[model samples]
Target: MLINVCNLNNNHELSTTEMNGQFVQSQLQIASLLKMETTSTDQKEFICKCRELYKDNKTQLHFVDEFER
Candidate 1:
């Protein structure tokens, strides 16, 4: 058995915000970060936000697949 994982953020240009708010290694996928949705209000919890200009569709999905646990 084998598994593959990729850090999509490794390729793009990192901005000051993404650099500071980076929640994972190096940074996050420009698209994945842009599409993140949260309702938290605290500034300290301001994570998963992109450049606010990232419009890529790579991480966009229609439905979340649920698995039986």
Candidate 2:
């Protein structure tokens, strides 16, 4: 897993496994912070945020596979 933490906070440095753990921890933290075990509104907001972030980051990744060959 070629995880990228380039957008993470300045004080953090995460390896692949650490990055995976961080992702799980992030979902847990978000759920806890919102004080919900499961809620549609919370889920929707989280999904939207993730989608936007993914799109932004994906655009930044100019992989060789995407080049005009």
Candidate 3:
């Protein structure tokens, strides 16, 4: 699920709040994708790849949250 936030003005700039919301939404979408892929794919390699991607994204999210606070 891609969440697109459009600016009303021509510049199309996103505020900090909007950016953060997008990040969170993207993370959730990634997690959902991982869950779906895990159930559909029986390959261990695919599952490991999904888990690594999830972990990387989760770490980035936490870092951003900490930096913001």
Candidate 4:
């Protein structure tokens, strides 16, 4: 249900869904970006960091994920 974009530039692109021509804009759902088809390197690193930070929790991510689904 999501559209993918392919850009060849260092600058952040504008969101087509909102702020049509805005730059440096970020979506509110950064944590779930890892599952996104267009996730950037920074988003992957941020997700990795979040995983490490809460990795010690007994419930664990996998369990939470399955439960969420």
**Best prediction by TM-score:** 3
Per-candidate clash tally: 0, 0, 0, 0
lDDT of 3 at 14: 76
Worst 10 residues of 4 by lDDT: 20-29
Candidate 4, after superposition: displacement of residue 49 in Å?
A: 0.2
lDDT of 1 by residue, 1-69 (tens): 112234356536877566566545334554565577745452323222321222353442111111111
Clashes of 2: 0
Better of 3 and 4 by lDDT: 3
| Superior candidate under lDDT, 1 versus 4 | 4
Kindly give the stretch of ten consecutive residues in candidate 3 with the minimal lDDT sum. 1-10
lDDT of 3 by residue, 1-69 (tens): 233443345344777787777778778876876777443345545445555556768876565456434
Q: How far is candidate 4 from the true structure (C-alpha RMSD, Å)?
A: 11.8
lDDT of each: 0.39, 0.56, 0.59, 0.50
Clash pairs (backbone) in predicted model 3: none
TM-score for each model: 0.21, 0.31, 0.37, 0.29
* Residue 46 lDDT, candidate 4, scale 0-100: 52
Q: Which stretches of candidate 1 lie over 4 Å from their true place?
A: 1-28, 47-69
* Order of candidate numbers by lDDT, starting with the best: 3, 2, 4, 1
TM-score of 4: 0.29
1-69 per-residue lDDT for model 4 (tens digits):
232343336344545554433322333334356466754775566556656765887567675445434
TM match of model 3 to true structure:
0.37
lDDT for predicted candidate 2 compared with the true structure: 0.56
